[model samples]
Target: MRFYGQQRLFELTTSELERYREKTRELDYCAERPEKRLLAEECREMVTELEQRKNRMLASAIRRRQREEIEHALDEAEIDAEEIIRELEGESA
Candidate 1:
């Protein structure tokens, strides 16, 4: 099979991203060691892609469950935005 956009959807949740991010945070990015530095660079790139939704997963040719998850995430973000706005307004007033 062929994908036009060619970006493989890895089907990841936000929690999965968080886990990877946390795991990477614990790693020692030792500048003295080439391998460690390379690892750090690669991990940073991967996490950046994941956060940008450009990773090999969670994408446009999405399955039903993935679509639902995206919708739910947007809904939760909307609620969080509203709460933040309310808090800021309360603080100002």
Candidate 2:
């Protein structure tokens, strides 16, 4: 017989989170510099592009982890289901 258990989520390592924070700090620093500020029209466009790319990369990383967890859970469920079916067949015979 198979029993369903709680699903424990796996989170990113401390180093990964720290690296993300560092990138955020760098972006803020770039924005605050007077000479390098994104005030100019051309610079504004470039800043926007950079921000979008950063956001996309972060989102992709989060989505990748979520996808992996879901895949792991599905695999576990398949194995449990197969075991249950086998046990039931044995009980009937």
Candidate 3:
């Protein structure tokens, strides 16, 4: 379902974040201070964005499951109502 796609995206984002962190650490040890700072800032922004995306995906998954459950409950209610009507009609005959 949609969860599967989101799960893949989550995994890819996590991997990318890890790579960016590693790159930042490597840059820290080198001579180019300005480049390192810029990269570090970019990495931080990416981290924030990815975190937000992950939260959204989690929320979506929860909402989807809840919707499915509600639909199932409604279907069961309708079936029960139909059975009750049938029983009432039979008794009247």
Among these predicted structures, which one has the highest lDDT?
3
Give candidate 1 regions above 4 Å deviation: 1-11, 29-31, 54-93
Cα-based lDDT at residue 44, candidate 1: 73
Better-scoring candidate (lDDT), 1 or 2: 1
Task: Please give, for residues 49-83, the per-residue lDDT of candidate 3 as tens digits.
Answer: 87787678778788998999999999999999999
**lDDT of model 1 at position 57:** 44
Q: What digit string (tens of lDDT, one per residue) describes model 2 on residues 14-45?
A: 33444555655565567767644434434445
Winner on TM-score (1 vs 2) = 2
| Model 3 alpha-carbon drift over 4 Å, by segment | 1-3, 24-32
Comparing 2 and 3 on lDDT, the stronger one: 3
CA lDDT scores, all candidates in order: 0.65, 0.58, 0.79
Clashing residue pairs in candidate 1 (N, C-alpha, C atoms within 3 angstroms): 9-57, 10-56, 10-57
lDDT of 1 by residue, 30-51 (tens): 5467776677677777788677
Q: lDDT of candidate 3?
A: 0.79
RMSD (CA, Å), candidate 1 to true, equals 16.2
Q: Quote each prediction's TM-score.
A: 0.37, 0.51, 0.78
Winning candidate number (TM-score): 3
**Model 2's lDDT to the true fold?**
0.58
